[model samples]
Target: MLSHLPTNHHLRPLYRLLALASGVYVLVFGIIGVVQTSGAETFDRSGDATALGLPTNPAFAYASVAVGALIVLSALIGRNLDFYVYSVVGLVFQIVGMLALAFLGTDVNYFNFSVATCVVSLVIGLALFTAGLYSRVGARADAH
Candidate 1:
């Protein structure tokens, strides 16, 4: 029972705009990640393995762009889109990223396991979870 399914609400436009912005943000970062690909580690900071000093592999760039593209698509096409689903996916990604960092922080994912990394993931996961869990859209039938 996601909100904003069938009708447009006052807040819908704002949410959609935010999604678009998020998409652009991630998309830009993704491109930057790909461009900074290098093997050697500098100050334990390897561009090939870390994007923005966050633990990442070559695949992370692609994933980020893909997520961004999805977000853009959803924002543009307002029909049959569930915002909650995307939020859940984001939440899940943060959780998985954290777990990976925890068990195999440095060696496994090549993540720095730095304070910044932990805080970033925590904030993202919490934000997504909070928004998704609290924001509810009435069923389509319930609208009219």
Candidate 2:
């Protein structure tokens, strides 16, 4: 279905760029998760054990691989408004998750870093979404 779609020349570049950025982010994060969870004995957050109940094992490695695959697929298949929508959703989730992590944090330094990263990610996501919207509008205008 994707192969048969006509090219919107104006939006194609923007879509590809966004897709690449998102895919890279996902892949990197997933890999980090895999490394962190692999044979990680230090349990800094005991709350995670109760809340997420994720076993510190090879399962996380598999999850990372799956995430990496999904990111690649999304980058390849995602285009048009779907890219913008998914980006927004991901940013929102990151913001909320970071806020929750901050609230649960005992250390000021960690909380500060988490909040800062969340803010930066949210800003970037908003900018990307705005660019996507503008690209679509510009394309429509040029077409008309």
Q: CA lDDT of 51 in candidate 2?
A: 11
* Full-model lDDT, candidate 1: 0.56
Residue by residue across 1-144, what tens digits does model 1's lDDT show? 544444435566565565566566666656766666444343233533556666554466666677767766765665535365457655775786578557653555543345565565566455444434433455666556
Candidate closest to the true structure, highest lDDT: 1
Candidate 1 Cα outliers beyond 4 Å, as residue runs: 1-8, 38-56, 82-85, 104-106, 110-114, 122-141
In terms of TM-score, which candidate is strongest? 1
**Tens-digit lDDT string for candidate 2 (1-144):** 333333355665675566457656545655655565555433333323211222222343344356445545654665454455545545654564466456635653221224444454455455444433433322444445
Candidate 1, pairs of clashing residues: 2-137, 3-137
